[model samples]
Target: MDIAATVIAIEFRLPGPININTAPAERLQELPGIGPALAARIVAFREEHGPFDTIEDLTHVPGIGPRTLDAVRDLITVVDER
Candidate 1:
């Protein structure tokens, strides 16, 4: 007689938060829930408007809102050289 079994495991990790002000789109996408389009929008919005004064300011971007902001707040930051 013979038997077969399978096992699986899932894991989640927290990478150090990224700085929104200076991080490239690729790096920005690493934030939870952010994708290529959203990351590009963030960068474009920053370039066209200006560096975000606070995390809440991300609301100005087309896709981000209070909910989305809250979701990734801990995984994002800003450092204004201005």
Candidate 2:
């Protein structure tokens, strides 16, 4: 008798860039290095201050620094819903 082995792989893609202006904490948490605390901060910051004018503005969030911003910059977008 002989046996064969098979390998499989799966890939996931976001429908599009996450809109930082509109994404909820749950959605924002999906970004790399953005955990619950940071995700909440992002939401709160936006609510307190207003939508981000630029992706770089995310750094203004308490926990989001240059490194964290860099990690998710390509995956995020800033749109003015207003």
Candidate 3:
């Protein structure tokens, strides 16, 4: 299934932790507990702080944590530009 399809189709499978380096707010919102505001916060954070080097960097954002990250780990992808 497509990413969106997969995300919404299954309740047990939470959305992935989006890659701060690449995903826009819309994509980031797909994750559980990340609404538009939080998603926007993530995008804005990226704009100010720059690319994320690791998933741990998500904690720098106000709403994320290890639990949230773990919830969505399977769905998120970090693309390496270099």
TM-score of each: 0.75, 0.79, 0.67
- Cand. 1 TM to true fold: 0.75
Per the 3 Å backbone cut-off, how many clashing residue pairs does candidate 3 have? 0
Ranking by TM-score: 2, 1, 3
- Compared with the true structure, what per-residue lDDT tens digits does model 3 show for residues 12-57? 5644445667988888888887789988988898899987777777
Q: Which scores better on TM-score, 2 or 3?
A: 2
Candidate 1 positional error at 28, Å: 0.8
The Cα RMSD in angstroms, rounded to one decimal, for candidate 2 relative to the true structure is 7.0
Clashing pairs in 1: none
1-82: candidate 2 lDDT, tens digit per residue: 2232222221233256899999999999889999999999999999999999999999998978899989998889997433
Write candidate 1's Cα lDDT for 1-82 as tens digits.
Answer: 2232222221124345678988999998888779999999999999999899988899999999888899999878786433
Show the colliding residue pairs in model 2. none
Give the candidate number with the greatest TM-score. 2
CA lDDT scores, all candidates in order? 0.83, 0.85, 0.76
lDDT of 2: 0.85
**Which ranges in model 2 have alpha carbons more than 4 Å from their true place?**
1-12, 80-82
